[model samples]
Target chain A: MTARTGVAGFLGRVTAMIVKEYIQLTRDRVTFATMIMIPLLQLVLFGYAINTTPRHLPTAVFSHENSDVSRAILAALRNTAFFSFVREAQSVEEAEHLVRAGEVLFFVEIPAGFERSLRRGDRPQILVAADATDPVGTGNALAALSGVVASALVRERFVGAIAEEAQGREATSQDAFEIVQHRRYNPAGTSQLNIVPGLLGTILTMTMLIFTALSVTREIERGTMESLLAMPIHPVEIMLGKIVPYVMVGILQAVLILGAGIILFAVPVEGSVAVLSAATLLFITANLSIGYTFSTLAQNQLQAVQMSFMFFLPSILLSGFMFPFSGMPQWAQWIGEGLPLTHYLRMVRGILLKGSGLSDLVRDGAALFGLMLLAMGIAVARFRQTLD
Target chain B: MSERAAAPAGTGERSAADVAIAVEGLSKRFGANLVVDDLTMTVRRGQIYGFLGPNGSGKTTTIRMLCGLLTPDAGRGTCLGMDILTQGREIRAHVGYMTQRFSLYQDLSVKENLEFVARLYGVPKPEAAAQAALERLGLKGRGRQLAGELSGGWKQRLALGACILPGPDLLLLDEPTAGVDPQARREFWAQIHALAAEGLTVLVSTHYMDEAERCHEIAYIAYGRLLAQGTVANVIAASGLHTYTVDVKGEGPREASQRITDLSQKLSAALGVDMVAPFGTSLHISGRDAAALEAAIAPFRGEPHLVWRKDEPTLEDVFIDLMRGKDARR
Candidate 1:
């Protein structure tokens, strides 16, 4: 046989390496099933389980006046569905204590002469203070307060005006009341908009990390790496060969998640598919490279899997997939900036929810590219060419 | 096969074009353990070189160094006319190494494994090459079977087939027939000999003396040191040991084994009796000084139940003696 040379030989060797990995992956039934099942299972589980617009928040109300106006206002507050009046506070201090003790998420206070002042057209105010530690839980509820209170007072005045006309007395205007919404935290609230795209990054990071993380170490543990090293393949070629198959798997997972998000949860994609695909491909490669790095660094398959999880924990927690990205402290945001998932989360959310284009996602895309390069570099450098 | 003349041992003066592997002072250390001591050996092209050693004696390490699977901690060498240190990749491309353990992708089918090797070597028409290898291995019908499911002998056969699928210049087989049955081992040696006859060099390691006798050249290393390097006859002749076989007549297999053990212990303590080992119903007593050995065994020759006959020392006798000699020093 003549010596193998030139581009054809390289391609042949790389293709063989890739084809071998594909065959092994297909043969491992449990692993193959897991690759497809994880994304679908997570999408179904997290998609419906997470809700930002929370309801039935426990609340306590303290009213000094035992009048019809205070009763009607309290009833109206209950109708908003955001507050369930679980406790009736006897004093203002007790109401605040209930909110602080976490038994109630909201507290309401009405002054003693509020009804009389409103009847005299003096514009007396009613106070509503809310526990706002979780901004998303209280944002929309507080925004809906002013509208509900004014309409309830208007209805009350209309009924009173009809009675006064029959009794020969004049009814004053119903615009004599003011509602002070003292609730703090995010006023805009959150929507399903952030969740679906976050799921895409999260699910991709999890499965993609484990997939390539086990590739090299599994070969080592099985004793096949000795023969592999004896072959005519470069380390970079082997890394790419191992990663290429999982990149395809990653794409499949991304498609499964995004497709499910759009179809099942009505999560919109406001950006171009091309940009999303490009960004998704970069993010997937970045994750696969990290997994491959772990594979090369670990001594055995178990250690490889452990290393992958070690990296996965930080990627999931700090990437803002679980928490609000901007709401985190400075140190966490700095850490988040270094993770591929963090940038991918931003890119995906920007594309799907914010209608971000290529220019709008340049920084995030560049971060993803840089992360991919860094991981690939480390993996190739750590890859052992000889058994020694 | 006709007997061929033996090459002079350790000279390694063969020209560059004819020598496939010629290394000098190849040493390796694994942390505190010196796995392969300063060792020098050569393999002429188209000749089968056999390695003999006990477990952990550095046979595998030497083979790895030769094939570029390991770098010597302190040494320089050349394989296939390329520098072993700098040209590892080039040497690796030309060497087919079968490890002591079964190292193929077990989940892959036999044919897929072969095709993977073939493609990696850039063999034209990998499918045809793999098919031909399967046929040659007599595994054509089992081409689709998972490699892990194959029996030991068949796995060894398929491993050899995969190694040769790439048509490497030198095949470094580390104890290729370790657990194989005698019949399969004979067939494997036949294949190795056939490959050698076709001008392909083979370096194989094994424990069986019969297998070592079949090689054109052999090296015996114990404790990371080369104790013997020559042909079978040359190594035995160089040892200068005088041997005698004593058969102890007995009532049954158990009693005969007992008598042989008793005689071996008695003779082991006697003066000039360097080695006394039991093989089946006979005891082989050998010593380096021939006259002392003869006198030492003369008293036993006249015993009623024992019959003695002079014999040439076998390779196992020579190796055990070498191991004992080394053990005595440590």
Candidate 2:
């Protein structure tokens, strides 16, 4: 006993601990496969299925005058990437029905006086109405319409100026044109690029946390924990033994997700891979620790899984994973920023596409580190006390 | 520390230096109810010590504390010469405990479970140890069988093998033969006695009187209190119950029984007759006072329909008397 108190002895014990854990892990085939395969599944599903930058938006037009000017506006709208002219309406009533039924997201109506006003050098009014139910769809429609309107106004003023110069009239009147632009992040915004990277965070968090939460509680239900506890092993050793295998799974998930993002959506890893990997590992650890904490509190495997879903629900909704962060109310924005997922998502996107460095990711990194320490500390403390 | 000669009780078979376990003032309480009260007892090495008690009499709790699986709330004791409090791990290491219910891995094979336990206890050469245990327990052919698929008797055998594979100095069995068939119970006791003969101290708790009679010494506890402690012969002698069997012939056994009950009450007032129980076509009446018991059944002696003869009080009579005495206290 005296001779075995040094480094050699400690290493021997650790090796025995690791070998025993691996043997037990291999015996449970379902859990082993889940650990290795779930990440790859998540990567492919989220990378290809989710796209935030909207394209080919369905639009309808209503023209009362049936003139060349009205026809020209419809043609210009179709020229942009934002709108795909789906139908034409003879009256406003027909266009309104299309919008309400969700047949078209945007509709343009030209009044009866439109051609007459343009010919008399007076401003002709045109109405652009878009469905506001889906905020993303409405935003894209408005962006494309604004570009079309500005060009039309510029051409009209140019024509009037040219006519005045040819008539040699006193240049008392002025031609006015203004183009107001509203740009959301990556404003020529490709939905695939924005959503694919964010999906990586959401998918990884849900799968990894849920799987870890069920692991311990399942053993407890099966009565295997009694045998485990009877062994002359420390609780901390068991915790580490359980987590090490899952950490490898987390890394594998990250690689699969990154690869899918590149191959399917051209999501570039513009930042340092090391920085991204480090941040990702921290966030995954935080999530796993949270799951372990739930496991300690739950009485059975089903309850533990349910509790994991409960945590995941608020995280996905309030973390700005699906919606634009700035568009939300101030309180919601504050809440979104406070969530651990929010910081991790921002960090992931910044690193993968924005080429963010360690210095650039300080805030997100600090938040994730704090969350990891807090969650792991609470989980270990709860688990140790739970056994007693 | 003074050397004393062995007491001449059961021939020179018992020795004074054979005290394997000694404990004093053992008490444990759960919340408001006391599960085991202050108690003192001793067990000799190479002996099967029977612990008999009714259900909820703290037999299991006492056994657990003795084996170092549980800590007594207030007590001082030594098990296998290790301090119960400070050297619990060491005590547990040297004591094999089998619970009433079968607690084993159902998914694992019998051999795998034994090997796992051996490794957990840090046994040297676990494979060899498990193999030897299996062969010794007559489970050599069924070592690879799933534990869940085994019958009750087979499961019991496997449990016994797992417990003894660690080579503990003492074995604590809590109702080890419960739910086992008559033949299996006999076989289990044979194994227990064999282990006891090899200087392995055995403390077993059971409700069967036959099992209690096989032990070198028996202790009966009721409601957290020790009711009796001694060999079967000594306990029966101390009970002081005298008995008489009355045989009734013809189709009037029931009528004769009623007539005897009336006679028993009359004699109880004058001579203190204790209990009169009907056994099929016969009646057995017993009392602690021998003179009173003989005088009480005198009236039924001269009839052909009822024949009364003096008989020895069985162990069952002694136990029934003890249970009645304990019940009267509550």
List where candidate 1 sits over 4 angstroms from the true fold.
A1-3, A63-80, A86-90, A97-103, A110-128, A131-191, B249-255
Local distance difference test values of all predictions, in order: 0.85, 0.72
TM match of model 2 to true structure: 0.71
Mind giving the per-residue lDDT tens digits that candidate 2 earns over B210-258? 8887788888887777777777777777888888887776647568677
lDDT of 1 by residue, A138-214 (tens): 86577667556655776677335533332222113222221121122122234455678888998899898998988
Alpha-carbon RMSD to native, per candidate: 6.3, 8.2
Q: What share of the true interface contacts does each candidate keep?
A: 0.83, 0.05
Deviation in Å, model 1, residue B169 alpha carbon:
1.0
Q: Looking at candidate 2, what TM-score does chain B attain?
A: 0.87
Model 1: lDDT of residue B230: 83
Provide the lDDT at A47 for model 1: 67
- Weakest 10 consecutive residues, lDDT, candidate 2 chain A? A170-179
